[model samples]
Target: MNAKTTKTAENVTRCLKCRRVLRNASPDGYGPKCRKKVRAAARAEVVAQYKPHQVAKAQELLEQGGLIPLRANRVFLAVSSDGSATYKTHRAACTCPAGIKGLHPCKHRIAAHILLAA
Candidate 1:
């Protein structure tokens, strides 16, 4: 290929997450560091928006597969801490007791936010 064609092909093979040119690109399109950094950044942004306990619970909820999207992804079903109940959650509202009070975003809401943000 000519020099122009070679340079254009290089740009097309950049890291998916950071847009940096990759010398040895992976099939998934992300460099190792960029992959980790992208995930960490998404998680960090969610954690930074809430209290520690809430973030922890949100992480638990996500890891446990407790959050299920519904209504074309506009709402979610968040399983309670004890797994005995589920709260209907939206981006700004949740049916959980803490959410009903409206004092702050509850764990369920935080979990939903994390899902949507990611």
Candidate 2:
């Protein structure tokens, strides 16, 4: 909000919804200009948090341990920001809502990681 951080100045335009930075920003405001860069930064964070090879190795461990099924009718894929997988028995009981609602990450995601690693 100060002198337009190089990041803010480069990637974001206005906030997608607010219109101020999407709401009350100049046509070339921070969010508008920096949105893509911001998105890339976020993506990098996600990737670093969840290393694919490590998580896959964890899944292999789970398979060896037999905590996770190879496939399930109700089973949903859940991955966490920290590279954890979600494993749940049921949607209602699932820590991740089985993907019907709450897109936010949940413990089910962690469970999957555990299962994979087991």
Candidate 3:
């Protein structure tokens, strides 16, 4: 079959990057290898924009489903596994110690960003 032609089984398409026959449908036309590269690039971008600690905290919150919405708009509470709540304001900043010190964006802020992006 020609390179441009789809596979017979369910008319499966090819990967855009490697031009290999795709076994499954991918919205971006990327097969497993290319998809992994794309995901890794996206993750690297996020890591570059945030501190390591903030990223770790955001990941933890996501894993634990710890982000909670508060009464106010653009406001949220990031609850830790230990049941501690850290206030985060999208427009302003978080109330965590790191946020209060203004040294860096806190984990609560990172978690809020991650949750909102999701």
Query: Which of the predicted structures, 1 or 3, would earn the higher lDDT when compared with the native?
Result: 1
Look at candidate 1 and tell me the lDDT of residue 102: 98
Q: Please, what are the lDDT tens digits per residue for candidate 2 over residues 13-71?
A: 44321233344444322244343443343344333455566445433432233232335
- The TM-score that candidate 2 achieves is 0.21
Q: Which stretches of candidate 2 lie over 4 Å from their true place?
A: 1-14, 17-30, 51-96, 99-118
- How accurate locally, in lDDT, is each candidate? 0.71, 0.38, 0.60
Residue 35, candidate 2: C-alpha displacement in angstroms: 1.2
Ranking by lDDT: 1, 3, 2
Candidate 3 lDDT by residue in tens digits, 1-118 = 6868765556758764445888787664557775565345436665578877768866666445455556432567666457855455452587766678978777777655654443
What C-alpha RMSD separates each model from the true structure? 9.3, 16.1, 11.0
* TM-score winner: 1
User: Measured by C-alpha RMSD in angstroms, how accurate is candidate 3?
Assistant: 11.0
**What is the TM-score of each predicted model, taking all chains together?**
0.62, 0.21, 0.51
TM-score of 1: 0.62
